[model samples]
Target chain A: MKKLVQDDIRTGVFICDCGSNIAGYLEMKELVEFAKTLPNVVFVQENLYTCSEGGINEIKLAIPRENLNRVVVASCTPRTHEPLFMSACEEGGLNPYLFEMANIRDQCSWVHMREREAGTQRAKVQIAMAVAKAAKLRELNRIQLSLSHRALVIGGGVAGMSAALALANMGYEVDLVEKRDRLGGILNELNMILPSNEPPDKLVNNLAARLHDNPKVTIHTGAVVTKTEGYVGNYVATIRQNENENKIKCGAVIVAIGAQPLKPEGLYNYDGKKVITHIELESKLKQGDVQAKNISIIQCVGSRSKERTYCSRICCMTAVKNAILFKEASPDTKITIFYRDMQMYGVENEQLFRKSKRLGVRYVTYDPDRPPRFDGESVSVHHLRMGRDIIVPTDLLVLSTPLVAQDDASEISTMLKVPINENGFFLEGHVKLKPLDFATDGVYLCGNARFPSTIREAISQGLGVASRAAGVLSKEALFTSGIVADINPETCCGCLGCVAVCPYGAINFIENRGICQVNKVLCKGCGGCAATCPSGSARLDGFSNQQIYAQIEQAMAV
Target chain B: MSDSQFEPKIVGFLCNWCAYAGADLAGVSRLQYPPNMRTIRTLCSATVGPHQILKAFQKGADGVFVGG
Candidate 1:
């Protein structure tokens, strides 16, 4: 890309109506007249929909005709439409980085629909700010990175296995590492899988067999990933086995280290023998050693409290499943479940809940303030419906505890350079849109590591995670944004504040030169280091300090 | 200027990922608010330096909001 001097800065402003989305609320003619008055704004045009084909062509044609050095589109948010305008500018012989955008529809028109005058004034100010920033906009080039074709699957759980299988089937080499001697993860201890009613080992064995037979997959048991370095396309990880450390390079990583159920040690006087968790009952039931004639189950044992606030989504269904199973095995066993609220979500779980009631399983809603009390033989609880204290004969007390994040979740999050929520679960990029991906490009997560998920959801997430990783692995080369930060070597004082505050580890201190430098490939353009640099040396290329100040000055002037 | 005649000027620096997306969502949902704030979309909240904020104030901005 060719660079242009400040004297050649000719900015063209395109105001968009968005097909009555913006025109219905704001005065378009006034905004256009206002945009024309801005400094260096040589051309101004109004579009019905700047993202439409005809609108884009007008931009392309106007660029060469008007000799535009910078293009500013005052339209809907740049989040969705910026790329279209930028590409149009590129086709018109202008660099894409020279394009700037102002959000008139989203920020002004839609927000102040009733206030026409005020909204138009706001749009004018936004256009002026964008034009001011455009005057200082510089062309930036994208950096292409080499990609590794292999993938790494951490934690050989159901999700991990599914991800590995999917990736291997895609003709990519996959390395699956499991910390335990076996590959099933939480599936090994589970008695019967839901929805299918098959034994847990059956699914585990089937996946393991498929993974083992595939030539692209290499399974490592009793192995853990101790270190992972690099970004999306190229990652190097060290797997630590008993005494040996083996290093493997892969393009993407899938985290499926499933969570563990809380033991409820002190709560409900849990002894693991008489007062045991629901998971403990699964083992006893599997062994055919559940000898109790009467069983009373307690829900929300160690969750939904001041400490652990989130309601573990799957625990209620687990309680219902166990209740139904126990009732079917021994019809005479008096089983009562005391819960604050039955969170049986979806059609299957609701059907299971109704079936449990049909099988003579009793459900009593107990207040958390006044919980059920056990005196070694019978359980006493205040029934909300009856408005009286009731006693139920109980020999085996089963506590259904929520599944918490894995013990080493924080360690893995740090090693991956990803973030974790306060509950220690790995946080995804966006809660709704990008559920299976981390903020970092290459790393993805699924199963209980993200949240307490059912076995079916975990498998689906595993497959979904593989697809997300493949989105990167399938690409021959990856291009990073040109908006990365750069430090002036002359002005750097080696304060290391930028280094200390960088979340992505993109900046490195040069000990020999006593300065800090930015690795452009690793930079995500968050600009944390640029703001923290006291000497004003570190400046993000696109969002320079001068550009932002110019914008503020323009905004205040209006 | 009279108290009622003087309209306060506010500049907001909205981060691209969160607050800016949220503002866009508000627009998509047609959630109305007073047109009292002028926004600048930034890559991150940290990109808004103290110098830029003081400059906004020095240029006669009544208030500044940095949202991530």
Candidate 2:
């Protein structure tokens, strides 16, 4: 009854040559030789490229041959190879999560080519840690969430409205929460959107009206989500409306809160009159600004290096839009755009750039290191292309700055249990493939919340996220990861340390056993809990440190 | 926890709006910060949680920061 489970836990350790990537610095032969010495290692092998199909086949062949239930591949970061090895284990009739990956290629050999001995030693240590975690990994079971069919979108901006309309059209019930007294977000204030030459108010109204009559969409105006608790499959959101926080629970949440305009407060001389922002310039254009013969529009303010360090992406287009507008209004107006690099990607935008130039809008290049100086009624710019300091007489100076995500993004991120990028925008899993998704399983984020996007991009993102949310909520019993976190209550100390550190709130302290319990549905398998558990009470299934240790020790020994 | 003046009662209103996740990232990155501030989460940058940041200041907080 008190058996070590050592007999039950059999492991196969494979050392990879990794083409020449790892073999150039690592000695694979000796590593394979050391594998046989480990306690639970039943099979030891060396592969030219363990990530290769032949290597995966070798792993599959060894599993049955050695009765291995655990596998550790000492090669590269799991980000690249963990899946291949796991699939091999699964084919061999073992749980997929019961495997651990050791990063010897990128994290070790590549970084320490000159210090091979030290790299191998560090690899050994890392493998030891992984194996210790993997040895205690139990068989994992699939997590199924009983999901509600409704979706909640926070924000009334172009992105949020688009998301609402998309989900509503798809026959999914949607609750759209907007903080402002009216919907339409920033789009409501715009006279005409760039490039399209369409009225923004009409589009904003059309989307809002469509969502209103859909019967599936519930519009919450003057509302704010003050408290957010829970995770995917089931989330409890408390929204404040009419000076009251209304609690609503839903299956999925979409954060489409668009960014605000970066104000020009102290930068240069912002009298809100002469030196105004791009947004102010929009209003100025609409309000019929008094005639000025020369107009200078500065690009990349508060964005794309040192200060912001991320391309706002839309500013250049805005500058071109304003320049074209000014040219159309006053053809005699000398419209100059100060830019670092103009990112006019799509064909239509490129055409717009040409159109603006043909219309007498002048383009000037300036180094970000040396910004063009603004002196009351004139402009002093270092003409990098011309190799001279040029002074251009200007009437109105417009600083085209970035539109940042709503100020409430961090709170919304916490409530959603999602991750945001370094620039404070929501981190999509892949920048291109899954642009609307968060790393957290069921939550989706889009629009300026991720980065500064134009109205067109925001609408596209809204529809895109709505489609993603529809996919998960459509199913009655949503299939989550079969790879759930495993814990050995017998080893737990009831410190609740792991529970406290969980960002997802998946780990909870149970009274009966006096140990932390993992809510499989909510656990993202980020390993934050296992990393925090001081008593070694909770161990992830298939990721015991022993298996990882054996693989690493064997790799280093070779 | 706030009884001692040495106990930095740094009451931080991390706007569910922005700063909370920044703090979380700082935590995940193991970013070393002064352990004086206790964060009270809020939904929006506009929605201050029950006058908590001000309360922290009143409760002898040396500095206050709002994240959203």
Considering every candidate listed, which one attains the maximal TM-score?
Answer: 1
For each candidate in turn, the TM-score is 0.89, 0.69
CA RMSD per model (angstroms): 3.8, 12.4
- Write down the C-alpha DockQ for each prediction: 0.79, 0.02
The segments of candidate 2 whose C-alpha lies over 4 angstroms from its true place after superposition are: A1-79, A97-138, A169-171, A266-269, A273-275, A287-296, A300-311, A334-343, A363-397, A410-435, A467-558, B1-68
Clashes of each: 0, 32
Candidate 1 residue lDDT tens string, A61-123: 999999999999999999998888889999999999999999999888999999999999999
Candidate number with greatest lDDT: 1
Error of 2 at A529 (Å): 7.2
lDDT of 2 by residue, A1-558 (tens): 112337767878788888887788766665666555555667778889988889999888888888888888888756456667887899988888778766566555666666666556555544543444457666666766687888889998989998888888888888999999888887765656767797777887788788888899889999888876776667788988987878888878898887788896787687788888888877766777657788898888778867678888988988888788778877988988889899898999999999999999888989978999998988899999789899989878889888876678887787676787776788887888788888766789888888888788888888899889988878889766665555678898889877877766788788987878998877765455665677666654433334323322332232
Against the true structure, candidate 1 reaches a TM-score of 0.89
Model 2 native-contact share: 0.00
